[model samples]
Target: MKKFIPYILILIALGIFAGYYMYNKPHAETQGAKADITINPADLLAAFELDETKANAMYLDKIIEVKGKVKSINEVEQGGSISLDTGNEISSVICEFEHAASIDGVKVGDEVIIKGFCSGKLMDVILVRCSL
Candidate 1:
């Protein structure tokens, strides 16, 4: 009975560890899925009052999707970035794509939807994969 008790405890511990691992592991859908919430850069600017530091920190390194008018498109040999007008009077949101494939076919004045991990006030956004 004593030997069995130790084995049972070990089994229980293993089960708990396995459960935790599964629970915390990133899902395939989540890794690729855009942020569930839709936000406009203008609205975000107004709500946060253009607090770049605060806003950047709040959204930084997080996955988000935003819709706005493309104010400008910057293309480089390697890749490029875009700035969304967000209709905000004071500021625009910058979305940067490190890879060229992400920004292909995007143009200024076009309304676009972007998704990616927020690196800062500037979003290190992944462009092509978003469904919207």
Candidate 2:
């Protein structure tokens, strides 16, 4: 049993290092990055509405670029979010940014293209870590 002590210690140390590395890992840069899937806001919403399971398998965690008129703009403590009109008052594509300043000049009714990672559908389709 004593002979395994050193091995156990090494394993613990390796685990700690791995955890720290993963915790501090940088987020993927979305600016100027090519999107994995590009779709219109309404089309995206329709796809999710039609088949949530299939949409989740295709869009979740993948970079998505959508072009639409901004339906609303919102600011949060950490960043900002904008909702793109999806032709449905009840649902829209919400894009989130890490920097509040990212939405500084943006306004509702403005047409813009946003790129982000598709998170999932929750009434609205959510896109995180977005960029213009």
Candidate 3:
């Protein structure tokens, strides 16, 4: 019984930890409310251009606020995607808004601020769960 007691305690601790972790899942609203960093779209793109791996380490999975000029916009059934000029003709910051509920009146050439999780560069910086 004494040996079993330690095993039982370990199980209980693990169960508690699992419960706590499950309770704290990532949510967009909460993440947008608190950005880890704020930077311009051009600067963010420049970082990746200089060193993709290093930039990924700095921005990946982090909530970031970016301000830039709108390059283009595309609407989809679910929502939409906005491309912000990164000062590079080839690449831009693509912000994916899972729900375009609030993207009314937005147009090209307009400057906007976006907050989302950085998913690293793929020819362009991708930001998911974006909010204006």
C-alpha lDDT (0 to 100) for residue 119 of candidate 1: 50
Please, what are the lDDT tens digits per residue for candidate 3 over residues 1-132? Answer: 788998999999999999998899767562338889999998999999999999999999989899889999977778889999977899999998877765678899998989989999998999988889
Q: Which portions of model 1 miss their true places by more than 4 Å?
A: 1-31, 47-57, 122-132
Winning candidate number (TM-score): 2
Best lDDT among the predictions, by candidate number: 2
Per-candidate Cα lDDT values, in order, are: 0.65, 0.95, 0.89
Give the distance in Å from residue 127's predicted Cα in candidate 1 to where it truly belongs.
Answer: 10
Question: Ranking under TM-score, best-scoring first?
Answer: 2, 3, 1
Residue 13 lDDT in candidate 1 = 100
lDDT (tens digit, per residue) of candidate 2 on 3-115: 99999999999999999999999889779899999999999999999999999999999999999999999767789999999999899999999999888999889999999
